[model samples]
Target: MTAMAAEIKKGRKFDQVLDGAREVFMRDGFEGASVDEIARVAGVSKATLYSYFPDKRLLFSEVARLECNRQAEEAMAEFDLSDPVAVVLHEAANRIVRFFLSDFGQQVYRICVAESYRFPELGQRFYASGPALVRERMSAILQPYIDRGELVIEDMDLAADQFGQLCKSDLFVRRLCGISKETSEAEIKRVVTGVVEMFLARYGA
Candidate 1:
């Protein structure tokens, strides 16, 4: 386990602390957020907060990990793995696009990019919780389809990663660069449809 992970101890107020931290981090970002504000928001004493999280960075990383996992799990729970490959791929594409454009998702991406140079572990944790986790779950969803000969994928990891990249298309950069404030449903469907079509063209059996 990471030193940060080792230091974090869960308690009855763990979620409460996380919730407050998330709000502060989202509003003020990692550097601007203060421990005092977080404790005040959580309604916990500074001492209580320090017991659960010895460092502010630890608290921030934990919040990011939990939120990313929660979003990914919620998406997976709604997926019908038995559906046709096209249907499942489309669902995955839509979920990926929506998530990449979300406020929290964008913030996490920014934080990882900004802090990874100084704190390599921050980026590692983000990858483990976000892209790596998604790839594993997506690979599981696609494996049965590949076995049934609906998709011809020699490398499950590469194919899953490609599908994820396809979902990004131009929109991800547009949002990241602040060219677009909100992605409409119609825009999302356009990207999703293209991703599914492109992926199936390359892999369909």
Candidate 2:
């Protein structure tokens, strides 16, 4: 059955299962988590769990996708796409990098990396939902700049990825390694300013 149709049949129960699964997966890791525990935590029968998510991989993928959506919304909720390009890019980079370097973000990143070896598809799912989503949204917002001759980007896809990676730089890696426990807004603003300057130098009209 289609997901919508399945949702219609299950309603909020499906969400409960997902919530339970997320808790279990995060706590136990993918290989260590058990479907039985998830069902118990969700307060649903095994049949209900199976009906909503036929397999562990599918369930895990959905859980990962939901978490990505949650973080993305939180990070970009107030984002305005119609601002001056420099301001917009700086704000976008700050939010994205800050979210990625946060404590919860590190936990989620480790979980994804740990599970990726066995279920490489989960890595792909996370990328598509997370970074790929940002790249597409940012590119869409910047296309008008190119058309208006405000910027000279020849490949918007590459440009979007470049902008995001520049924000990451050494910050995200150092955070993941526990080399730094925090990133101050002042630091982030400094980093983003340089990134914006570099980008403008390359793409300015």
Alpha-carbon lDDT, every model:
0.86, 0.77
Q: Report the Cα RMSD per candidate.
A: 2.4, 4.8
Candidate 2 per-residue lDDT over residues 1-205, each given as its tens digit? 5332233235569999999999998788777789999999999998899888776766877787788778667656666656777887777777777767765466567767877776666667767876787787778768877887888988888998888888777888998898888787788878888888998998888
Supply the TM-score for candidate 1: 0.89
The global Cα lDDT (0 to 1) of model 2 is 0.77
Q: Note the residue pairs that clash in candidate 2.
A: none
Point to the candidate with the largest lDDT.
1
Model 2: lDDT of residue 12: 61
User: Candidate 1 local accuracy as lDDT?
Assistant: 0.86
After superposition, candidate 2 runs with Cα above 4 Å error:
1-12, 20-41, 45-47, 50-60, 70-77
- Stretches of candidate 1 off by over 4 Å are 1-6, 26-33
lDDT at position 190, candidate 2:
82
Across residues 166-204, which tens digit of lDDT does each residue of candidate 1 receive? 877899999999999988889999999999999999999
